[model samples]
Target: MLELVKKNIHMNRWKTQVDTQVTLDDDFIVPDTMSDIAQVILDSGEVQLEPARVQSEKVTIRGKLDFHVLYRKEEGGLQTLGGLIPFEEMVNVPGLEERDYVSVSWKMEDLNAGIINSRKLSIQAVVTLEVRVEALFDTEAAVALGALQKEDDGSGELTFPQIATKTRAVNAAAIALRRKDTYRVKEEMTLSGSKPAIGRILWMEMRLSGALARPLDGKIRLEGTLLVFLIYEGEGESETVQWLEESIPFSGEVEMAGAVEEMIPAIDLRLVHKSIEEKPDYDGEMRELALDAVIELDIRLYEEQPLEILSDMYGVNRELTVETGEACFDQILTRNAGKCKISEKIQLSGGQRVLQFCHSSGLVKLDQAEAGEDMLSLDGVLEVKLLYLTDDDSCPIQSVTELLPFHYDAEAPGITKDSVWYLEQGVEQLTAVMAGGDIVEIKAVLLLEVLVLQPVCQSVILQAQTSPLDRRKLKEAPGIVGYVVQEKDSLWDIAKRFRTTAEHVMETNGLTSEELHPGDSLILVKEIVR
Candidate 1:
């Protein structure tokens, strides 16, 4: 009689111990939650065990039979077992000395013992093993500042300064295993946020990928969010100046291959997962995470004002007084070739009494003067030189010496005209004194306002013996002719100048080459020989 027993095996309870110490040359700074770790798990399907009972003359006992096993590494950390071993051919059997431990062994099967009657044993069991694995990861760090402030509106101002900071890192791992390994791990966490108007922040974000044991020598796609902040300026005199401030956000990405140590700020990092956390403070606010941070800042100011202008017009002459003595009066009168002086006492006034007497060839005649209740008016003819002065001052300063109405005729040596000279025409031709004390000459252009005479061409009689020449003779005639210099003028310009065909010019000039030089000249004949 044969009997059968069924046993259940708990696969989760099995543990494989790999006792090996692996040392890294440097201390590994375990990155925050953003760091990535590379590892693999293999599955070894159920193993079968058989219970066999062997009957002998001495005693009746049952012995477990063993089976042959073959294992092969497969994709995704999987192993396969093949073949079997017969109980009769087994020289030694690996058994379980204690309930906590079990030893397994197997051998190849031969064709001779193909069939056995209640001799071979097959058992089902689960296998779990632990292997030494290492992963490599790269680390990085980054920072940014805000604009400076001044105390006053002008360049030199004293005010409180503020700045913001940002930093990030990319934690990636590369798998360095004896065989190909594949498994999934949780993605890294990224942190990012905005800063307050008054405060700035130091922000950073990191991206991690690949295995963790060996150096990361593969391409990594870096991606992540940006922590933004707005550095605000302080309020002014009134509370109305304290309005809502705005914050700016930034985001970007970077791609890298092989190993990377340090990363620059404001670079985007590729990541599998990310999270953001916001923290507020009294002076400012900060957004931070295990891998990233953005700092807020508040800039304060006391007061600012415009700079005062300093006046430096010192020692400048503002007024002048003229005293006319007897000798000076007589000298001035004698120098005037055509002088007409006032016979009676004359007082010049009216209109602020600001006047300057200048002479080019004559003198001024204060013929009459009338003194009113509060003003004195004088009539005079300014001869030789014309005097011009601002109405604010009563100084005889010469403005334009040659501007006086005077004439030098052969008959009259120096004669003064009493009439005022007006610029009736050619006003544009007048030159004015520039601010630099130099005369700027201007061109005088006269535009005709009336119609002018038009020229008339009359027909001419030509002595033609046989027939009258066609009126289109000028239009149809070959304007000019020239030989085509193999390397002379271009066919286009040459043809245009002669009003002829480019093909004709090319054929006439060349016979061959298209290049031309300076010494090479082409003949341009007129259509009409005359």
Candidate 2:
């Protein structure tokens, strides 16, 4: 006879489509006729991955991204061109079962653009798509009652609770903020003594500063400064570029139940639509610029749950053997982040003399990660683009791509090679200057956040029960027996080996605890009621 045990376990699954290349082509007409092109820049690209379908040996993901291409026309103005690129990719993930929860995200690593004609252009980009899933599996478990030591009473029954463990990545909240605000200012500096008329807006950068996300009143309250930086071509006898910076205070609320400051919240913001028209009201100079922008934000939260499990058990003293089940459990051992800074002088490429440096900006992307005994090593790239003046005073933009490698080891001593990692690299501060030998001396502070997950395989007891004694093989035993404890021996094992009760053995030997030492003498007195 055997006891039946039942348990539930939670686990996580995932698939990745990393290092995938894609092509984007567009044929757009500018306001002015085709001529010499000044510059081509990708304003923004976004992808929204749909739900994934898990197959026998793979997972299928489908999504589309909206990309924008901005260029300068020969007639001293900027042109805006855009198109939507649809994509589909298949990833191989072994042992994927149905009925698993899945989440997906897409990221852009590198993009290269070229001019095919006056109104036609071609762009290529490397995109990475990742899918993660959470699932629940049911299992059985049981432990046997102690083996019979005395004569059968035909009155004792046994019972045990059903115990199981499940691990899962739960979504805490989702936040969507719609902000419609205005910025009234007369602060940006003009190129000449007089305010030259604004020619064309070249590029704009939106950054969130001093941002705080907290849960309150069954909703997520976000407070931060929406910083807007604008670069434009100031119209004059000679074409000149001017810069304008503004910090617009914004406060909004979104409904997110159970959202707190500790749970990980990933925010993705986009300038869905924007309109800025210059309005100079009777000042005889440009003073007020009406600002209107539609900001779209997508926020998803995730939390990890890890637990301990119970496997098998058997009755003592009675004849019994336990059956166990084996499985590979995937769990998030540790998921955390830390703040870091990387300071180094980046060497310039060749004989370019620096007259003056205008502005510096960059993006940090994690490429790969590896784990040691107690540390996690991360590798990534910092795509830095600088706008500066040459010795000849040419204002063409010069870009540089550099590698940023770092190691993170703190409060982590159990990290192994099979651990999976993630990063949310943020650029806190980036300051630079032109050195004596034309080197770009840079001082950058970064928020190097990391997430580590280590999954291990363990076996648990499935079921156990007592093996009945045969009446035909039963033999009459003597009233007393002599016993000697040996090395690596336990009271329960000794009692089970001698077919006697542990309590009777301890009481007879004058034992105080469950401990037994080698060469210790004991007397076993059996009180059978046959």
Q: Runs in model 1 with CA error above 4 Å?
A: 1-480, 483-490, 511-513, 521-530
| Candidate 1 lDDT, 43-111, residue by residue in tens | 111113232222221111122222222111121111112232222212211221122222222211111
Predicted structure 1: clash tally: 66
**TM of each candidate vs. truth:** 0.15, 0.69
| TM-score between model 2 and native | 0.69
What are the per-residue Cα lDDT tens digits for candidate 2 across 123-229? 66667775554444432222223333343322243323221222232221112222222222222223344545566666666555444444454566666655666
> What lDDT does the true structure give each of the candidates?
0.23, 0.55
Highest TM-score model number: 2
Q: For candidate 2, what is the lDDT? A: 0.55
lDDT score of residue 263 within candidate 2: 48
